[model samples]
Target: MGANEALRVAFRTFGCKLNQVETETLAARFEVAGASIVGPDDGADLVVFNTCTVTSKAEQKARREMRLALRRNPDAVAAVTGCYAELDPEALAAVAPRTVVLPGSRKDALGGMAEALVAARLEGLDLLDELRRLAAAASGGLPDPFSFVPGEARFRSRVQLKVQDGCDNRCAYCRVCLARGRSVSLDPDEALRRATSLAAAGVPEIVLTGVNLSQYRSGGVGFPGLLELLVRGVPSAAFRVSSYEPDRADAAFMGAFSLPGVRPHLHLSAQSGSDRVLRAMGRRYGRDDVLRAAEAARSVRDDPFLGADIIVGFPGESDDDFRDTVGLLELMRPAWVHAFTFSPRPGTRAFDMKPRVPERVAVERAAVVQAIADRGKLEFARSRIGKTLVAVVEDGGDEAVLGDARRVFATSAEYLKLEVRGVPAGFHGSCACRVIGLSDGDGSADLVSIFI
Candidate 1:
């Protein structure tokens, strides 16, 4: 690619909402530096893979996608980054030809290097070699994990405002903490400023995200305090928390739900509900903590959509331990349960633990959890059959279709998927939706709404 020619860049992101936010930020920078952001299969000159290494499967998927992207565009150069690259750069670097690995810590500099590469007008293997050399040099030092790079590219309806990075906890099964290092938070003032700016720019909603959102602290401001600041500062925009840890869902944290404009949806990082399993996993909180968090959220918000992440078949987990997890789920009845089979990652404490759970057993437990989750979702959807709720239009137009029919897809404040109809020609904002019925195909609540 020459300086005069705009580089066609495609991005494939994996893992948390934090990674998605970072990918959007990178795409904005590339667009500013005279590059066209294209789809993964659109045949681009450069492709960026924002990978995840939370589990072996995530890393495997990253590798597979990287090779597929390269195959789709035979002459494309690849730029890999995120937790996977941070933990195993060499593995990603060797995945395919004409690829360079940029670790998570030094991700902010990737755009600058790409700009320089574009200006250099080098192509083929030469460009990839130079990018690799630059990545090696940039990997020498640690970076400010909470570094902010401003951009105006609003790719999605809800903008993700990342206020924190890294983690302080040493959860036995997690490899992300090792890759991201210690906790680092963005300044509260800066966070507020960014939120206000996004709201002013006509962005309807902003999602606060971080690797460990509950661990956020800066200048005597905690996550709840920062949340209050943004809610008060930007009255025009809605706010959502990406995910939070169960132990940190204290009184103060729950109080944020009472604030105006705060969305009534919460996804907790409740790895397991079994006290014994939680203890073995090095989690500080017990099963009661998760219950209390759920209770607190319900007490504050009106039928809030409570979601959680639960790991099945962890090291040394017994039948009783698994029962405890299911019992907790029965009590909470979370709208969404992200049931995951424990994949022991290398470099984590759980990797070498003895008496490993059989893969077949793990899969069975996951299926059980998933069944309960699906039932909970259906029950929740049924309960809202005749209620009117606030929803944000995610995808809709005159020609928008849902499974062969025309419909507008929206997400309610309680995080329910709504297929709405009978609105304006191109409705795309927050509105009051009346749940009419449920769709037979996907079970998404059918609704009717108009732009507010």
Candidate 2:
């Protein structure tokens, strides 16, 4: 890159909403530092990969993508960070050339590094050497993913505010806890301040995200208390809660659902519906506890979009146990479910468990669960045919269209994907939309809605 030319940067994030938030924050920093942001395949001068390690599949995908991105832009500097990088920096460093491994703990250095790179306009071996030297000197510290750099511009319609990070539970099959360590929360006052600022900036929605939201606590405030504070303090911006623990879904926690500002979408970290499977997974709650949480969500809102995460074919999970899981889900009639086959992480207790479910059996069970979940999701979308929802336009402009369809894509407050029409050209931000029809069930299973 020449000194007169601006540095082009690309970002690729793999994993949860938390990782996405971190990527956005880093991109904002780079942008504010005068770096031009481009797509990963746009032949950028720098490519940043914010990776995940929750599943072996995720790590493998990250490695594959990293190699491809590096190959496409061989001279581009690749700065790898996040959980997978934190766990095994050496493995990621070996994936591609001109790579700088900055683990999650030391990610705070990215902003300063971006500023330096823009100022010096370093590239090729010189840029790689500088990044390596900086990475080695960077100390351990987790950056607040929600915090933005000074004068950072807000472009997205919705913001994911990560008020907490890490996990306290030692779930048997979970490697994330080992990578993230104990829970840490942003101070409630600071959280509220940041949320207020975001809402004031015309961000229509704010999703409170964390590794485990149920473990949030700071300045004598629990997760429920923090929710109440944010909901009441920023009534202008709609709120959404990310994946949370079932055990913590107590009366107080459920009360937050009653607030009008809080959207009617809730996803529980219910690993299994079978009590035996739950026990083996080292979960704190049982099957009935999950049911209670679901009931609470239903009681608070009309036809709320309820979701759960299920791990199938865990060690010692018999057919009967799987049946119990199906039964529980059937009773709950969740709007959506994320079903995954058990993945044994190297350091987790479940890795050494006996009488493991065969890989073939696990795959078959996962397929069955996924089929049911897909049907449930389609049914839920169909159920909202005549209902009006608050939706935010995520993509599509006046000139951006698919074939002859001049429509924009949006997401309802309940998290329903919508193929919206009759909105003005270049529409962005929240609007009242009524579900009118369903899209063709060919590939895109989105609900058809129109602006009222």
Candidate 3:
């Protein structure tokens, strides 16, 4: 195609941080290939939907977005990729007949796909070979799923960097193992280079995301080493680690928070509070171990934003087991709880487990766990009522400005009409805001004013 006729592309991402990183990488590839990247509403010549299928709801959402994308740009060459595409390509194809379905492992081939689409438009003959050659030349013996080129993400403030890919765990309720193969880390030098560029771009935060981040091991260095290099090396930006397994929460891993730029937040997955349910689910950590990990993280950083994942109403869970989970939540009082009702995945071991919990019971258990989370969050917010927190001002709506507090509440929509304390320097975009009073309805605080 002529320079003026170069394709325009848009990407829509769903699911976890890994998907976000991959979406950024995909956008970079299109930019490098001379495609004009546009926002989802701009209606590009090519629309790429990066999907997730972690839960049934996620799958439905992905499908809904795919349909919407196709409707938005009916003439565009639609492409579907990521976990959802890998798991069910036919489903995606059915939704968008003209859509090109790319597998997760083959996502690196997007650049080649874009090239082919462009060349076919120009030559009006078969150009697949030319596109394939270009991709092979660019890869240069890197793995099939090549690491994304380091670049400033289109969204500048917060960048999701994929330090690792894939998973090796055999969790009974997870199909990630089938969707994404064994674990592998990105080259440490490449990661550092990307982080440096992000810092240079004035991005204040970079989150290290992966299928299983704890399994990061590259070039004779572990996750801790990579974190130390990033935290110490790139002093300009704050770094955050995404979800981690409890077994991976060792002293060295937790110690990275002591570094200047590392944020005090840890999201550990504790599927069940009952020991019996944990064993049945094939999770490594029990109730005690979960509490111990939480305590260890807190010990390193006082009042760190501790978070946990809780799956309620798994098969064979008794009422006492549910109560045990509530007891643990009360005792540990984590900053937040991601409550998910147990759903039997098609290929998972839990699918065939006997004495399955009824759907209604699972829903009720989820509500109970959610109540516990709400109570804990309120308590955490109340504890910080009179303190001043460094808030990263994100969205300034008509009623209030929203940002995360230091301790528990990450994003607060508290009204702005409260008494004035003082607005701190650089308070417009990001600043320190003093907490005056807690919102009576939700746990969000009524900001006294921005601290000067």
TM-score each candidate.
0.94, 0.95, 0.83
The models' CA-based lDDT, in order, is 0.83, 0.84, 0.72
RMSD of each: 2.7, 2.3, 5.2
Ranking by TM-score: 2, 1, 3
Candidate 1 per-residue lDDT, tens place, 6-71, comes to 678899999988888788888887777667889989878889999999989999999999999999
User: What TM-score would candidate 1 get against the native?
Assistant: 0.94
Clashing pairs in 2: none
Better of 1 and 2 by TM-score: 2
TM-score of structure candidate 2: 0.95
Q: Give the local distance difference test score of model 2.
A: 0.84
Q: What is the lDDT of candidate 1?
A: 0.83
* Segments in model 3 whose C-alpha atoms lie over 4 Å from true places: 1-6, 32-36, 39-42, 115-146, 153-155, 395-430, 437-451
Across residues 1-452, which tens digit of lDDT does each residue of candidate 3 receive? Answer: 33336667889999877777777877877776667789776867678888887788888898888788778777666777788777888888788665667766667667556656565545544333444354345444334553665453354445678888888788888877778888988888888888888887766677888888889999998898899999888998788887788877888887785665777778888878888889988988789988888888888876777778999878888899998898888877877799998877778898888788888998999998898887776676676677766554442333323333212222222212223333322333334557776555542434334443
Off by over 4 Å in 1: 1-4, 121-126, 148-151, 395-406, 443-452
| Lowest summed lDDT window (length 10), candidate 3 | 406-415
